[model samples]
Target: MWNTRFRLIFISSSTYSALGLLPMRPCSSSDPKPGCCPPSPALKTGAWHSHCARSASPAELCRFRSLGPGTSGDTGSAAIESVQGAKNVDIIVLLPKGHCTKIQELQMTTVLRENVHVFGVEGNSDELDEPIKTVFADVAFVKKHNLMSLNSINWSRVLVQIAHHFFAYFRCAPSLDMHPLPPVEVVVPTGAAGNLAAGCIAQKMGLPIHLVVAVNSNDIIHRTVQWGDFSLSKAVKPTLASAMDIQVPYNMERIFWLLSGSDSQVIRALMEQFERTKSVSLPKELHSKLSEAVTSQSVSDEAITQTMGRCWQENQYLLCPHSAVAVSCHYQQVDRQQPSPPRCCLAPASAAKFPEAVRAARLTLDTPAEILALEHKEARCTPMRKGDDWTRMLRDTIEDLSQQWQRRFLNLPA
Candidate 1:
């Protein structure tokens, strides 16, 4: 619940050193540090949810305007187009099956320069139950290709990058008028913990990163997080925030690193602190760095849909399901004016990516222009029938792209 007088946080050159270049710090905080903790090394495994995996489920999640009472900002809606120029250059898109849409896949894959790489992460959302566990499975799958895991475990670096980017983005932002030295706090939607974990590291760098975590009713983060206590179990299912859909975020290591006080003696102390903190919830020192955590407060499938449509009506914008969950919950809270700090939300992905979720949201939108534009949007998809089958389908996608590349670039064969 820490609110900052500043609106932007930046990273000086020194911050980069802490990411890895600089040596560790001594373990000393004014407050007494917590005890140590350890976790089981064994990872659980399960099958892909293939049954109806291919079925076209709800493809969209909405950010609504609340046509009625209880809506947040969005002065007006004008069938907003769901496009944001590339947020990052070196983007690593982890595409899971049954969870991605044709537009999303293409938006991720087609819009890339040589710097961007999109890989098909062979996975099934419904079957796995927890996306976090499946991340290692995907890592294992990628290891065969000789690439190391870039999963959120690598968040230490991402946070470093984002922290530095905050300096640049905010300095260039209209709010700051290209000014210098504005105190900044960042609120990010936490998923595999990479986003939040990296965010905390950035906070250490002086970006004042805030983890405005949005969870579904499933209560994975909310239930697991604690100040003096240990983190809770792996995960729970069927929550509103699907993308925050992870249970056992692999970025726990990075979090442990951030909360451990100092790099020098932090691990040993944290390991010991974790002893009592294990099996319950993450200690407050670590979770508090996240800044704030909010559940879409019992968001339902229908509520998500309406929220999405309302976003279009009010802001001329559309948000995907996961983003919708975040926006809806966030907006609902703002309507109450909870007297907390002003929360800034980021739409991590585009709404068009999830067509079904959009369809649901569109019900509330009801405008002819919004509906027609949605129906006629240029969508591209591989149409995988199941999640497990994506691996084989990936090869076909590569071949098809290769042919397209040749035809477009070489101008040879039909």
Candidate 2:
């Protein structure tokens, strides 16, 4: 696994290009440039997990925290395991109660680490982010506590995800010898638009990629791409692909900034409008640019099930609902006899994480023995009820943890 010494810095539009953290040019040749890029932390580390804590002094307590709406359970589970036994680091994850599948919830709540804090919030995943954002907004508090967020809002997460597009391009490209590398189609099943934003960045860096944004019933991203209607629906629809059930794809602003030639002013104005009205018609010119950069489709619950069953029947490979959403787009392309480049469907979760989806597909569940054992483990999670001031609670928790660390460091009573 790759580890970097740098701490998480919230990237802004003006500074992202200047940071030069990623490549600006496309691949020079087809031979799959050996070490063209470093392995992304998401793959080497864990979902939304950062190595910032590793750089802390022995006596200092570094906190790596995240807010997750708990779609598939992978992010919380991975984040928890990444710092399971680290003495100087703690991970605090907030997951929406009853929103995730039982297995997904168990995977996180069953962890018995002293430094791991999992909260079952009585709200949607999107609602959980508000309090975390509020806490992180406090510059002094964050600096004093050595706090870092391993969420999509953090640039590192997006930076790591960029590697996926490059790897997929190299794997699927038919030839490297041509003057320009052969284009490949990347089908992304996304929510919050983090991975989609990464793909857009990859394309900007000269990767010859056609991005197909795949979504389930929550089709705001699809609608925006297809019709330039950047507006939220009445409500987020629950689907088999629960993780992709997002009304607002927040990362679209990043994509807009990149595609608009890093025009931060225009993006800021547009986003301000969106925030104020919960809807905005994209400028004709920007909408045109977005359409050229990516195609989109919204898969239905029925299609997710059919695609899952079809994959199992044809290839003996079970797919999670989220993955099936992307595959469903691919199937549509083939069924219509559309000419397309080599396509790679990004599967962001495992079928084992969602036995309910597997059952919906009429496929035998293939959960591992270790995963099956989670149910019997002692489970624990703090509840954030409807009337609670979640933001204040989060602040209090962080302060409490910091105080506890200080007490232990001084050999004082708990």
Candidate 3:
């Protein structure tokens, strides 16, 4: 049997490039080649359109462009990029708006202006929580929009754009800071978009991190990962884990792309098929590739509820419903006699965000009032719309801002 702990084998950028993975290279006077985009002929269907459909040769990918204030020599930018490329950069948390409650967390960290764009969406946690003005130059254009309306294509494009922009900001270099990079063992709490984004970003950056997509009872992602079939069943059943009550995960397009050996034509065809019939199965070879790096599991709403109370009772820590899903998955592994490496589950919200869910779980555990006081804390965020025509709006915003940023990026003062 394999050791219970996760043993990470780090691969150099040049080796990854040789293996047809990524074109990343260490920052130096030499050009840092970019990963290739498939030829236009290979992207004739599915979400491929506009700039994404065009072929980007290796040279074109290598061009260093600018979007804002940063040069390859910038210490802050170097710290950020090197952190991503380093073997020690382990678990990634796509923070749920206010991952950092205090402003002190921003010390010496490079916060991109585009991050504020993420906060502007109404009911977006970052709107109330993120220390925006302190980080970005402009937060005016970032507005609240319906998140549910984001379709596969829109999500794919947004994630790709964000990942590329973030990674390419500074040429890859060794960090000047003291933060040692940690190897990524598993990325937990698979809530569709975040998990897929983590996977896509890891692939793009050429990091060898296994993805663990933890899900609540809405188990499409779990099922897809386990069965190699991407499909939608009936409508998603609402539960205490409201944030993860999703039947169809749009970011699966990115996962499908990676699973299919980065063959644009194959991914385009699969996505088109899914759009039509609500199901698509990976080819045998592709399925094998996916199994190498990705695994998923489902935790029921009851398990989430129970886990929340158990955390409060046993560990004296309150867990939000979504976080409970991840905890439940971890324990489930133990129950099945399977070993899990050291893992970190992302907590998307404060326990106070879901007072009712917390109260219900804590009451069952008969917890004291003082600990549960987190429930009554004043929260400034509003409710997000369950559904809306948000796709076009987000696309427009990302495209316009990206264009402006690209110009700024290309015309940097050298």
Query: What overall lDDT goes with each candidate model?
Result: 0.39, 0.72, 0.43
Error of 3 at 98 (Å): 22
The reply for model 2, stretches above 4 Å from the true place, is: 1-52, 55-72
| Candidate 1, residue 222: lDDT | 47
303-414: candidate 2 lDDT, tens digit per residue:
9999888766655666678878887886786665555566666666667778888888888985789888998899999999999999898878877877887776677998
> In model 3, where is the ten-residue run with the lowest total lDDT?
10-19
lDDT measured at residue 54 in model 2 versus the true structure, 0 to 100:
55
Please report the TM-score between candidate 1 and the true structure: 0.50
The top-ranked prediction according to lDDT is 2
lDDT of 1 at 2: 24
Most accurate candidate by TM-score: 2
lDDT of 3 at 144: 20
Model 3 per-residue lDDT tens digits across residues 254-356: 7667666679998888878887898788787877766666777788778888887765664466666776776676555545655433333444433544556
Give the CA lDDT, 0 to 100, for residue 105 in model 2: 85
